[model samples]
Target: MVYELKTKENENSVIEFIESVESPKKREDAYRLLDLFTAVTSYPAKMWGPSIIGFGSYHYKYASGHEGDAPLTGFSPRKAKISLYLSMEEGTYKRLAANFGKHTRGKACIYVNKVADIDVEVLKEMIKQSVNFSKKMGQS
Candidate 1:
């Protein structure tokens, strides 16, 4: 059997999408994140699916044989919070999460209500590490 991922990269304008964010603050933050992600990864922002603003992409396959391409790092400014998609070694994630400031986590995402609530330096470090890890993944 084959599986397809719904969130493939598209030609949508990232600025337009960010403009659509309902909250003024969220929209502002989205733009800030766009710049931050681009600066950190040195990659142009692309729209993934309808909402997420993504940077460079990487391909991955799980043990179950499900494989797909995904942005190396990305974020979605949702109504409740911004969801950050990043990669980290377990030990590094644990060490960084402590000093990561106020935020919640999921299996593969970090949720922050606003960027100001967390440490931007920590965010930058995580993004840098994730991009590095993803580049390595593409080589393997």
Candidate 2:
């Protein structure tokens, strides 16, 4: 059976979603991230699912036969922290994470409490690398 993707694009406005973030500080950081992602990726911000603000796009097919399209990079301002969705080789992620400041990490996500909690320059470098990787992967 084919699986459905929950993170497909929606018609909701990105600005509207960012504005809805409860914390004033988080809201401000959301806007900052939106601008930074757009500028770095050179792609318009688009709403992914109900919360994530995404830039660019890439298609991936995993070994398990799961295939889907996703933003090259994105972020969601949640109640506890900001979740950054980016793609980097494992070694690169580790190196960057060392300089990324106070943040948590999963296999592919970086979590920060606020923009001030991390190094924006490292974040920008990650974004640039993610976008370049996506392009090299043949994303349109």
Candidate 3:
């Protein structure tokens, strides 16, 4: 089942999820991610699924015939790392990743340990690209 976005009443649960992280550094990193995502996307960040913090919304269907609505882009604060979702066609992020400093990509997701580990300007550009890509996709 698809997870719905959280409501204002669910804010406490979101806060508590952030608070439950054992590492202070990771907790702060998650907040920084939240801030950066909000700043760049201008879409109110909402807790979606179990651990994902998402911005905006879109509908998608895979070539295999699976279809669903989901956040246009999002991230997750996991135990080992932070995952940033950049919604783009396959291979579109390759050039950006070359200048992104220390990061690992899995499909559309970019994983990093800390924001400082990557170039923020490149990140901003990537975010802009992803947002624009999603916008265009939504229009189609």
CA lDDT of each candidate? 0.90, 0.87, 0.77
- The candidate 3 region of ten consecutive residues with least summed lDDT is 3-12
| lDDT per residue (tens digit) for residues 80-128 in model 1 | 9999998878898888999998998899889999999988999999999
After superposition, candidate 3 runs with Cα above 4 Å error: 1-13, 89-92
Candidate that scores best on TM-score = 1
Best by lDDT: 1
Give residue 42's lDDT in candidate 1 (0 to 100): 93
TM-score of each: 0.95, 0.92, 0.82
Residue-level lDDT for 10 in candidate 2: 76
Return whichever of 1 and 3 wins on TM-score: 1
Model 1 off-target regions past 4 Å? none
Candidate 3 residue-wise lDDT at 117: 98
Model 1, residue 127: distance off in Å is: 0.4
Residue 111, candidate 2: alpha-carbon lDDT: 90
lDDT per residue (tens digit) for residues 1-140 in model 2:
66889998777999999889899999999999988898888889999999988887888877786788888889999999999998777788888888989998877688999999889999999998877776666443
Clashing pairs in 3: none
